[model samples]
Target: MLIRQLEYLVALGREQHFGRAAAVCYVSQPALSAAIRKLENELDVTIVLRGRRFEGFTDEGRRVVGWAHRILAERDALLADLDRMRNGLRATVRIGAIPTAVPATPLMSSLFSTRYPLARVRIESLSSREISRRLAEFELDAGVTYLDNDTPPGTRSVELYRERYRLLVPADDELARESVVEWAAAAALPHCALMSTMRNRRVLDANMAAAGATLVPVVETDTVGALYAHIATRRLASIVAHTWLHAFGVPEGMCVRPLAEVRPRPAVGLIVSDREPTSIVVDALVDALSGADLSEALERSLPPVIPG
Candidate 1:
């Protein structure tokens, strides 16, 4: 049977109505019905349980529908593979990243663009757990996330950088005068923090607990820029990724100090599936990371801005 017939079958199973399924398939009702009938004839089985209207699939038809899903998915993947091979990594490469790692996306995109200037690079800000789920389902080409978290099976993670927390404070703030701030001391200040839903927020929370500090943030937000805003006004302080200061300078009037004596830093890195015959785009993206030290690279690229 043709793939169209299989599509018709899948649509029928999903919609559970002949006219509706035909509409979804963008074909006449009779044409869809004829295709599936031909499918049933070739297989020598009654595929659908029919009445005046579409009933449901029989046991055998259900099995065929399951196979159809896998076959269609594979078919699309094969076409994508062939296109990439012919186009030389020109297809859109979708990369998901945790919010804290977003600053690194522009660097990766710039690297990928050098070899394939025409290629489209899409970067999405997502949670670590959400990135893992999307990676497992093949919805995302790669992910930039904490490599130490529970990784999905069949996915490989390559550490790109060790992410450390930094305390951001106003320039005139007494704490900002210090070159290094202890975790307990930083956590004790009246500060704005990332919302509890963020993975980095959890990491900071654990670090505070381990440092025997009580963290009662005066304001909580989901975005780093908001925290920076509060701290910029000199009304509050914040803890944020050290790397973030590279792409984005510490807000005007604010300074950053490295957090000290905290728990071990987590490694944030690139994650892709280990499934054989990886997509060329994925391969190229990984290759772009070769010999790149995220921390050092960022430091060299953006010299210490004087909080401008």
Candidate 2:
């Protein structure tokens, strides 16, 4: 089948609506439908289950879509390789990062851009699971996520740093003057935490559990900015990653204290698909990371947890 036909099929699989998929492919509805039909005839398999509206793909269609993803990814890789040979790394590197890892993304992106000025970098904050799914589906070139757990198979990673925690509290809070706060004490305060769905929240929960404490946050949210707002208003305290301080610094009305109980720091890193004939853009990013000293860079840029 033609590559354009496969493009239409993949877009259809993603959008799940005939009109929307056609729009994505920049084609008329009839044109997209006819191309898929032609593909089906050539393959001798019904790829779509049709009805009054856009029905889901057939069982065989799902298999075809899987192959389509692989083919399109390889095709893009081939084009990228040729472009690099001629133009020297002119492609966008799409990256998905967990929220906790978002602050560190600039370090990686800046390094890549400096090395390959013609290339572009796009970053999205996504859940670790979403990162893994998109990487597997060939939607992302790389990811920044926890490498110690839930890393997808068939991928390799390089650790950037170990993530440590701190208790962020309003400047007027009882523990605000302290250089460190014990987990048990922090858990007892009015606290807002990441939603349980986030892997960072799970890591926080496990760490608290190990410290003979449990977090029952007064409020739960998915974004760090929300947590920061709550603490700034003196509505709650929070356990946040040390990396966050590097991005946001301490909010004007707040301060962060290192957790008194030192636990195992989770390793956060860059992950890329391990399949052969890797994308050139991905290779450039990997090469950039090879010379990066993000761990030390982050530490030096961040003000002390308890400002002197």
Candidate 3:
């Protein structure tokens, strides 16, 4: 089917309303509806359920919508490739990064923009699973997420930096007397750990279990802000990624110390699909990431894994 037809069909699937989808495509409602009908006839499938209002797509229509997404994505990539060939290296770069990695994004973006002044960057915060999915779907040009895990086929990863976990406790706690609180020691204290939903929390739970301590958190939250706010009130202690400590400044009377003997420092890396040819914008980002000293940056701004 024609690319424009696929576009109209995809918009209908997303909008779920003929008038609304037509508005999105900047076409008259009847014109958009006629294009979708043409597409359905060409494919020999009933793509949409007809009614006074747009009801929904049939199972066949849903499958077609999935294909339509990939087709549109590939079309955009092709156009982007052609533009890059005609003009210099300048285009929008879509990126997905894990929550803990957000702090480094601005630094990396600034470095890239300074080097390549003409390009634009769009960043979205997402979980590791979502990042991988988006990368495979060609929705994201690249992603920053935990490495060493099994990556999707036809994608390659490059190590950007190592992310270490730390114990964040109020300064007045008994463990705060020490410069570095061992994992065994910190685990014994009442923890204000992240809820079980976050990967960081899972990593912490595994490490704490090995240290002969079970996390008995007084409070649990998904966001760093919630954890920090609880810690600031002296109501909870938390295990957090060292980078998070950098983004959300450590509270007063808080200590950050590395947890010893945690498996896989959880290297955060940039992942790009091998199937889609890398654009100049992506290449520049890769180059900047490879050369940058992210560890040093983390140390300068981020608090020590434990209170100093």
Question: Which candidate number would show the highest TM-score if scored against the true structure?
Answer: 2
Over 131-250, each residue of candidate 3 has an lDDT whose tens digit, in order, gives 887776557889987776555567777776787776676767776667656777887787777678777677777777778877878888766667778888874677777777777777
lDDT of each: 0.79, 0.87, 0.76
Worst 10 residues of 1 by lDDT: 299-308
Candidate 2 on 126-244: residue-level lDDT in tens? 98888988898888999999987578899999888888787878778888877778888888888899999988899888888988999999999899878878767755788888788
Residue 1 of model 1, lDDT score = 72
Q: What is the Å distance of residue 258 in model 1 from its true position?
A: 2.0
TM-score of each: 0.75, 0.95, 0.83
Candidate 1 CA-lDDT value: 0.79
Cα displacement (angstroms), candidate 1, residue 219, comes to 1.4
Q: After superposition, how far is residue 51 of candidate 3 from its true place, in Å?
A: 7.2
What ranking emerges by TM-score with the best candidate at the front? Answer: 2, 3, 1
Question: By the TM-score metric, which is better: model 2 or model 3?
Answer: 2
Runs off by more than 4 Å, candidate 2: none
Q: Which candidate leads in lDDT?
A: 2
CA RMSD per model (angstroms):
5.3, 1.6, 3.1
